[model samples]
Target: MVQYTPRWVGKQEESIHIAHIASVKIDTNLLLSNVLIETTGGANPIRCHGHHKADAVRMKALIERYQNDYYRGGGAPVGSAESTPAGR
Candidate 1:
């Protein structure tokens, strides 16, 4: 015996697809903190063997590139917590 399933005639048309883009909040303190933690020479981790100033400059550049990409790709607002609001 075969079970019959109702065919969907473009049923997904009514559904809304909301995209979530993770935005990076660039803070010097936080960047440096992460670099330090990762670079500590105890175990194998993402290590940065450079001066703080240099590392900061590099990270800042990276952050700017990411922000540009986000803006270009029509990313969601800079600080929206929920995936989607009830109404829209």
Candidate 2:
């Protein structure tokens, strides 16, 4: 899970599950780095900022790994063949 706290008032905190994430993008300027997380639900993408460029890169890599694993069935699904009594 990823939790984001807004930089200003009147904005509620947001939490996103890795499984629900569709993509991770990074944008960097001279002083700040932003990580944009797009979700399958089509809501506003979660924007995480104030990170270093290297940190943003790492975050993108991690999210991509999770997304890849999620799509490729790297983790066993509930009642999947790997979880069946005979297949176990």
Candidate 3:
């Protein structure tokens, strides 16, 4: 989740599961960056603003890696598979 404290009334937070994420976009200036994370549920996109360019790039990379792993592994639990179908 990305959180921002706005004037102390309450904090605002945004989160999306890797499988629910529709897209991740990044916009960069000379030094700063912004990220937009869109979800398949059609809710408000998560807006991440004013980060370093390198950090934004890293965030995008991590998200992509997670998404890839989730899809490639069929959302399996960590180390749950053991016996082969033909054997068991």
Candidate 4:
């Protein structure tokens, strides 16, 4: 899960699993970037801001890589909750 937790209380944390992520949009200025991650469901998108350009690019790349690896059944380690066993 990609979690974004706030420092202050009374605000709920945002978490979007790799499988649930539908799309990733990035807006960049000269110094900072904003990454908006929308989910497959109708839930609100995860909007993260104020990141370096390289960091923003790298974040998108990593998410896509993980998504591909997950679907290929090689990303999740064996005997972990994220990975299901064979034969139900």
TM-score of 2: 0.67
Please give the lDDT score at residue 11 for candidate 4.
57
lDDT for 82 (candidate 3): 31
Error of 2 at 42 (Å): 1.1
Descending-lDDT candidate ranking: 4, 2, 3, 1
- lDDT of candidate 1 over 1-88, digit per residue (tens): 0112235653221211122212322234533523322212334433233336566566546545545655665654334442246423
Candidate 2, position 66, lDDT: 62
Candidate 4 lDDT tens digits, 1-88: 5565566765566666788889888999888999988899968878889999889899999888778878787667334466765523
> Which lDDT value does model 2 have at 88?
75
**TM-scores, in order shown?**
0.28, 0.67, 0.73, 0.74
In model 1, the runs with Cα more than 4 Å from the true position are 1-51, 76-88
- 88 Cα displacement, candidate 4 (Å): 14
Candidate 2, residues 1-88: lDDT per residue as tens digits?
A: 5574656665566777768888888899998899888999999988887899999999888777666665677664444577467777
Report the lDDT of model 2 for residue 42: 98
Query: Which residue pairs collide, candidate 2?
Result: none
lDDT (Cα atoms) of all candidates against the true structure? 0.37, 0.77, 0.75, 0.79
Query: Residue 43 in candidate 1 has what lDDT?
Result: 42
